[model samples]
Target: MRVALLILAVVVGSVIFNFTTPFHLGQIASNWGLIDVTIWITFVLCGLAFIILGILMAWWIYTYQYQPGQLAEYEPEDPVLEGRLTILTTIGVVVMLAPGLIAWNDYIAVPEDAIELEVFSEQWTWSFRLPGEDGIFGYAHNKNIDIIANPMGIRDDDPYAQDDLVIETNIVKVPVDKKIKVLLRSKDVLHDFWVPEIRAKMDSVPGMVTYFWFEPTRTGVFEILCAELCGSSHHAMRGEMHIVTREEYQLWLDDQITWAERKAGVVPLTPVQQLGQTVARDNGCFACHNTTGAAGTPGPTWKGMWGTEVELDDGSIVTRDEAYVRESITNPGAKLVKGFSNTMLQLSDDVTTEDIDALIEYLKTTTPAVE
Candidate 1:
C-alpha cells in the first residue's frame, strides 16, 4: 500500500511540475528589459511555492490511509509558521516589483538630448517632418496650403519654418543610441505607429496629436507597421527603419534635404498637375510610370494617359478630350479604362477643377514617345 501511494504521488508531482516550469521559462525569455526580469523572478517564486506544496502533499500521502488507526498529522494553525509564510510572500512581491518600478521611471523620463520629429498619418500613408539646422519647426495648417509653393500645406510665413525638412513616405531613419520623440497626427483615419524592436507605439488620431519616444540600442533595419487596422491595405501599410551611427544618420539627413529642395524646384503648371503628381507619387504609380517604359504595369501607360482614346468604365469609348480627361482625373470610377481596376478613388472632391486641367496638360506634355 505504501509503495502504491508513493508511486501515485511521484507521478502526479512530476506531471504538474514539468507542465508548469517550461511555460514560465518560455514567457520569461520572450520579452525584454524589466518585464523579462520580473517574469523570471515570478517564475522562481512560483516554482518554490509548488515545491513546498508538493512536499506537503507527499507527507500527507505517505502518512494517511483509509484503514483504521491510520491518519496524517494535522497542524490546525501555527502562529510562527503563518508569520514566516507572510514574510516570504511579501519578499517575493517586493522582489518582482522593484525592477518594474525602475523601468517605468526610465520610460517616463524624456532625455535632454532627444531629437524631435513629427509623423503625419493619412488614409493610407505616412509623412515625416524634421526640424532644419535651426532645430525648430513652425506651425502649419491645412488651410495655408499654397499648391504652387508648399504642397505639404506648411505655413511658410512662420520664420521658424524657413528650413524645415518634410518627406512623404513611410520610411524613417534615426541614429542609434539617441532618443527620438515623434509627434503623431492623422489626416484621415485612426492609426497606430508601432515598432516592436524599440518597444514603442502611439496612436495617430485625426484632429489631435499624440507622441512617443524611444532609443534604438542596436544598428539594424527594423519594420514600422500600423498596429491598428485602418483600412483595406492595413497589412501592406508598412515601412523600414534604419538605425545607423550618428555620422551615417547625418549624411542621410543632408541627402534627404537636398533631394527635397531639388524636387521643390520642379514647378508644376497648375494645381491639377500638382495634385496628379502628388497622388501618383503617393500611390506608388512611379513604379510603373518610369521613363524606361517597362511593360508589366497592367494598364494604359501613364506616360501618355492624356490626349488618347480610352475605353470608359460604362462600356463606352471616348476620345481623351479636355472634358473627358478632366472627368477621368476627378471621377476615375466613372471610367474603368478597360484593363485597370476602378480601385482609384474619386479625386473630384479632393482636387479642384483647375487642378485637374493642369494635371491633364502636364500629362499631355510629359508622355514618353514610345517607338
Candidate 2:
C-alpha cells in the first residue's frame, strides 16, 4: 500500500508539472487542433499504462515476498490471465494508433479552393513562386535551373510559367483566413519547411514535389525555419512570412514581377551591369544579398539602394558610392551593415580590378538611380 501511494504521488506530481511547465506549443494559428488532441490522447494512454503496470509490479512484489517456511509454487501459463492481458494490450495499442491515422487522413484532404504556393530551397537560401491570374503553375525542373536567367527553372515551353509570379527573396506574403497548399521543392539536397505557429511542415526533396496545406486563422508575421539539417550553413537558413488581410495580400502581390517580365528583360541591364551581374552570381554573392526589393534578406538588398544613405554597425552614415562599393569588395570587413551579421564571405585575393568594376556596375542597376 505504501508503494502504491508513492506511485500515486509520482503520477500526481507529473500531472502538476505538465500543467505548470513553461515550455509551450507557441501559437496554434492553423486548423490543426486535431494534432494537439492526438498528443493529449497519447499522453493520457501512456500515463495510464505506466501507473497500472507500476502498481501491479508493486503489488506482486509485496504479495510474493520470500517467507522462510513458504515454498513457492510455479503456476506457469495461466491462460485466463494471459488472455486478459493480451486483450487489454491490443486495445491500448489501437487506441494510441487510431488518432494518428485519423489526423493523417485530415492532413492530406486539402480543400479544393486552396491556393497553391511553391517554396524552392537551395543551400542556405529560400525563394517562392505563386500562380498567375489563371491560378495555374508552370512546369519547373531541376535540370533547367539557372542562378540568374531561370532561377526556379520554369520551363520555356510552358505558357503557364510566363505569368507565374516569382519572388526571388526569402520573404513571402499570404492572405489570412485562406487555405494555402504549399508545394515544396529543393534544387540541390533535402530540406524541410517549418512554420511552428501554423503547425505545418514538409520535406523538400530534390527532383520531386512534396506538399502540405494550412489555413491561417490570424494576421501576423511568422518565422520560417529550415527544420532539416542540409549543410554547414543550415542554421542560417531562415525566412519571414506575413499573413495579412486579403486586400493587403493582393496589393503586395500586384507589385511582384512575373517570369515573363523577367524573361523579356523588363528592366534592361547595361553591358557593364550585365557583366557585374555575372560576376556577382559566379562569386555566390546572391546567396545572401538579395537582388529583389525584399527587406528581410540576410544582407541589404542592392535594389533601390544605390546612392542611398546607409547606416553602419558603428552608427556612422555613408553613401553607397563607387569608392564605398570598391572598398567593400577588396576589404569586406571594413564596414558592417547594421542589423546584419559579419558573416560576409571574403573575395579571393585574385579577384581583379576589372571584376570589381563590373560588379559595381551591376550593383548600380539594382537601384532606381540607373533609370
Candidate 3:
C-alpha cells in the first residue's frame, strides 16, 4: 500500500511541479512561434508517458505482491500485448517527431527579400560584414584571409568588395522586423552562434559556411554566446547583438568605411615606412592596433601614438619615444599598458634591431604636432 501510494505521489507531484515551475521559454522576439508549439507537443507526449507508466508500475507492484504457496505462470510471449505496445509506442513517437519535421521546413526556407549578414567567428572573438550599396557580397576564400587588410578573406580583384562594410567588434546590429539571412564562417575550428531570446542558433565551421535567418520583432540588445565547447576560453566567447529601428541602423551603417578604402587608402610610403608596415604585418601587429584609429579595438591606435604621453599599468606616465616603443615590443610584460589586456606576446625573437629602428622612424612621420 505504501509503495503504491508513493508511486502515485511521485506522478502527482511531478505533474504539479511541471505546471508550477518558473523555468520556461523566454518571450518571443521572432516570428517562429510555431517552434514553441512543436516543443510543447514533445513535452506533452513525454509527460503523459511518464505519468501513465508511473501509475501502471504502482498498480502492478501492489497487485503482484509475492505469495508463498501460489505458483507463477511461465508463459513469456504475448503477441496481442506486443502488438498493442508497439502501436502505442509508434503513435507516441509520431506525435512528438511529426511537428518538428514540419517546422524544420519553414526553418530552412529563407524569404526572398531578406538581407545578407555575414558572421565571421574566430577562437575568441566575433566579427561581422554587411553588403555594400550594391547589395551584393564579394567572394571569399580561406587563402585570401589577410588579417590586416582583408580579414574576411574577400577576393582582391572583386570590385564588389570595395564598398562592403566590415566591422570587427563585439556588437552585431540589425534592423527590427527585417529578415536577415546570416552567412556564418569561421577562421579556425568549429564555433556556434546562439542567442537565447531570438531562439536561433547555427554552427560556424572553418573551410565552409553555414547559415540561418531570423527577424527581430522588437528592439533590444541580445547576448550572443558560443554554444559549442570550442576551446579553453569558450565561456568568455561572448558578444552582443543590438536590434534597432531602421533609421538608427542606417545611420550606424553609413558611418562604416569600406574595404577598398582600408586597403589602398594610404599613399605610397617611403622605404622606412614600407619596412615598418611590413614588419608590423609580419608580426601580426594589426591584429590589435589599427592605423585608422578605430575605436573599441584591443590595442591602442598606432596613428598619432608616437611622442604621445601614454599611461602604463603601474600608474606611470611615459612618452611613446623610440626607447619606449622598443621596450614595449621586446619586453611587453615589463610595463603593461592601461585599458589593454596583457595578452601581447614578446616580439624580440621575431624582428631584428634594424626592423625596430625603421618602425620607430615610421611612427615619427605618423604623429602630428599638437599645436
Best by lDDT: 2
On residues 37-132, what C-alpha lDDT tens digit does candidate 3 reach at each position? 888999988898999999999999889878899877898999999999999999989988888888778777889999999999998889888989
Candidate 1 vs candidate 2: the lDDT winner is 2
Q: Write the per-residue lDDT of candidate 2 for residues 261-361, one digit (tens) a residue.
A: 98887654544555576688778898888867778777888888788889999999999888988888788889877898877888876678888998988
lDDT score for residue 104 of model 2: 84
lDDT on C-alpha atoms for all candidate structures: 0.67, 0.85, 0.84
Q: What TM-score would every model get versus the actual structure?
A: 0.48, 0.65, 0.67
Runs of candidate 3 exceeding 4 Å displacement:
1-13, 264-371
Off by over 4 Å in 2: 1-16, 55-76, 264-371
lDDT of 1: 0.67
**What ordering of candidates by TM-score runs from best to worst?**
3, 2, 1
lDDT, ranked from best to worst: 2, 3, 1
lDDT score of residue 311 within candidate 1: 70
lDDT of candidate 1 over 149-239, digit per residue (tens): 6545677567777677776567777888788877887767899997766666678887777885677777887878899999998888787
Query: Which 10 consecutive residues of model 1 have the lowest summed lDDT?
Result: 23-32
Say what the RMSD of model 2 is: 12.0
Better of 2 and 3 by lDDT: 2
Clashing residue pairs, backbone N/CA/C < 3 A, model 1: 272-355, 273-359, 313-335, 313-336
Residue 208: error of model 2 in Å?
A: 1.8
